[model samples]
Target: MELTERQKRIIQIVKENEPISADNIAKHLYLSKPTLRTDLTILTMTGILDARPKVGYFFAGQNFEPLLFEDLYEKSISEIMVPPVVIKKEATINDAVTMLFMHDVGTLYVTENQVLLGIISRKDLLRSTISNTSINKVPVAMIMTRMPNVVTLQEDERILDAGYKIIQHQIDSLPVISKDNPALVIGKVSKTVVLKHFIDEAMHLKK
Candidate 1:
C-alpha cells in the first residue's frame, strides 16, 4: 500500500520521539485526536508502527540484539515478576473475585500442588455472574480455562521471542513458566514489556 504524506509524517514523529502519546502527536501537529487516530491506525496496519494500550505507538521493523540487553532484562523470573495472585482448584468463585480485586490483575492462575492447573480471567467471572450463577458456591475450577490450552513462555526465552508470541497468539500476556517445572509459572510478559523494549531499542539506534 502506498503511504500517504501525512502517514509518512506521523511515522517520522513516532520514529523521532517514540513511546510518544497519540494525543501529544495531535497537539504538536495541530491535528484533532480523531485525525491522528486515523493516521496511527493506518501506520500500524502497514507494519511501520505498533500500538500498545496505555503506552502509545512505536516504530517497528528494526533488527535487535537479545544478548545486548540480556543483563538488563534477563533477570530470573522471580526477580522481575509481580507475585501471581493464584486460586486453588477448590477455591470458591468468590475467592477468585477477591483475589482479582486484591491484586488488581485481570487474570488469576489456578494451581494444584504448585502446578499450573488453569486460569480464571475477569471475563470468566463476568460470564458466571451474567448467568446468575452463585459465585460463593461455585468452584473456580468450574469456570477456569484448563491447562494444556493455556499459552505460556519461559523466562529463559529472549524478550524478543516473548513479544513475538504475544503478537502471534493475540493474547494480552503470557505466563512465564519455570524451566525446571513447566507446570510452575514465574511471571508474565505483557504488551507493556514488549513495547518498552521496542521503544528502548529504537531510541538506542537513533542515538
Candidate 2:
C-alpha cells in the first residue's frame, strides 16, 4: 500500500523516538489522536510497525556491532532462523489448536505440497470456534486467512533493514525466503527475537 507523505513523515518520527506513546506521537506531529491511531493501525496491519497494547510503538532495533551493512547483507536467511511450524489446509481446527499450543505460536503458515497457501492465526481459530458448533469438525482452511500476501527478505539483507521493514509494515514477523526460491520458506524473523537482540545491544552499549 502506498503511504501518503504525512504517513511517511510519521514513520520517520516514530522511528527516531520509538516505544513512544500515541498521544506523544500525535503531539509531536501536530495531529489528532484519532488520525494518528488510524495511520498507526494501517501501518501495523501492513507489517511496517509494531504496536504493543500499552508499550506503544517502536522501531525494531538491531545489535550495535559496528560492522558495515555489506558485512551482514551477504548472509542468507537460513543462517539465522528457526524451523517454521506449519499446518496443512486439510487440517482440522482441533489440529490447529493443538499445533498452536505445542509450538507456542500465535500463527501458523498453512502449506500444501511444500507451498504456502494461507495462514491460521490464534484469532482466526478463536473466532471460528466461538461462532461455530464443532471446533474439531471444521477444516482450518475454512477460516484461515488465505494467501496472506507475504513479505520476504533476502538472506543477505542487513538485519537492521529487516527491522525497518518490520516497523514499516507493522508486522510481528517476516518470512525469510531464498532469493532463488522465493516460494520456499527458509526462516522467520519474529518481533520478539528482533526486540531481544536490540534491547540486549542497547543495554550493552550503555556499559
Candidate 3:
C-alpha cells in the first residue's frame, strides 16, 4: 500500500517536530481530529510510523528512497512511459526547436511512420541554433544524433533499465521501442517520470 499526500505530509510534520499531538497535525492541515486519527491508525499499523504514551508520531524506519527504488525496480516502463515526441527526419532544426517547446520534452525522436531514425535533444538544438546562421533551413537529419548511436529501451524492460540508462548515458530521456521491432518507436521515459511514478506508489491512498 502507498501513503497519500496528506499522510506523507503528516509524516514530515512528525519528523520535523516530533512528539506532536494528533490534534496539532489535524489543525495544521485544517482537517478534523477523527479523520487524522484514522490516518494515524493506518500508518502505525503499516509500520511506517510509531506512537507512544503521551507522545505523538515519529518516523519508524530509515532510507525511504531505497525502498521506493526497489519498488520501482519491479515496475515496467510501459506503465509510465509517455508517447514519444517525434519530429520528421526532414524537418528543420528550427522546426525541432518549435516542437520541443510545444511538447515540452527534453528529447525528440526523428522518425517516419513510427520507425525510429534519429534523436535530437534540447542541447543539440541549442548548440546548433547558437552557432549556425540558417538553422531553419538546416534539416534535423543534419543535427540529430542518428540511430546506432541512440540509447533506446524495449517494452520488455523495467523502469530500472530506463533509470540506469538515464544515469549511464547521462541523457535526459530514453526512446522506448517495440520489442518485436526495435526500430519502431513506441514511447519515451525520463528520470522525472520514473521517480514521480515511484513516489506516487510510495505515498498512495490511505485505505
Candidate 4:
C-alpha cells in the first residue's frame, strides 16, 4: 500500500528521533496530536512503525515492504483483467466508432476468425473520418495498429510488468493475449483498472 505525504513525514521524524512522544512528533510538523491519530494508527497497524506503552514510535525496519511487493505488485494480470471490447476485421470505421462509445472503451481490438489482427483507437477513427467522407464504406483494417506493432500482455504476466509497459509506452490500455495461442485475444487492462485495483486493495487492508 502507498502512504500519504503526511505519513511519510511522520516516519522520517520518528526515524530521526526514535522513541519520541506523539506530542513531540506533532510539534515537529506544526500539527496537533489529535490530527495525527489516524496516521499514527495506520503506520503502526501496517508494521511500519512500532509503539510501546510509555515510549513512542520507531521505524519497523521495512517489515511491510515484502507485503507491498509480493502481495500487490507480483499479482497476475488475469486476476484483475476484464473482457476486451472487440470488433471484426470487416467492420467499418463507423461500426468501430459506435462500438467504442457503446462500450465506453479507449481502444477496440480487431479480429478475424477469433484471431487477433489489430487495434483501433479514437485517434485512428478520427483521422480516418477527417480524410474520408465515406466512413461507412471504409474498413477499420485500413487504418489500424496491426499485430507485431500493437503492444499486448499475457495472462500469466505480473501486474508490475503491465504497469511498466503502460508507463513506458504511454498507452492507456493493452489487450491480453492467450498464452496457448498468441493470435487469440482474451482480456483487457487499462489505467483505470490498475488504479482501481490498487485503491480497492489499499482500502480493504486499511479496514
* Candidate number of the best lDDT: 4
Q: Taking the tens digit of each residue's C-alpha lDDT, what string does model 2 give over 104-193?
A: 887788877667677777888888878987877888988876654666566666565676677767766676666786676666777776
**Candidate 1 per-residue lDDT over residues 1-207, each given as its tens digit:** 245688778878888888888998887788988666545754664357888989988999633344434533444444444556677999998888888898777888898767888888888898887885688898988998898999887767765466456656667667788988898887776676556655665576569
**After best superposition, candidate 4 residue 23: deviation in angstroms?**
34
**1-207, model 3: which lDDT tens digit per residue?**
356799889889888888778888888889888667656765664467788878877888743454553465656878889888889988998899999999888999999999999899999999999999998799999988988899999987987677667766789999999988998999989877876875577577323
Q: Give candidate 4 misplaced runs (Cα > 4 Å).
A: 1-64
lDDT of each residue in 1-207, candidate 4, tens digit only: 567799989999999999989999999999999778767865775578999979988898855565765556679999999998999988999999999899998999998876889999888888898999999998899989999999999999988788778876888899999999989999999989987987777787779
Candidates' lDDT values, in order?
Answer: 0.72, 0.69, 0.81, 0.86
lDDT, model 3: 0.81
After TM-score superposition, the amount by which residue 20's alpha carbon in candidate 3 deviates from its true location, in angstroms, is 27
Candidate 4, 197: how far from true, in Å?
Answer: 0.6
Order of models, best lDDT first: 4, 3, 1, 2
Better of 2 and 3 by lDDT: 3
Candidate 3, number of clashes = 3
Worst 10 residues of 1 by lDDT: 63-72
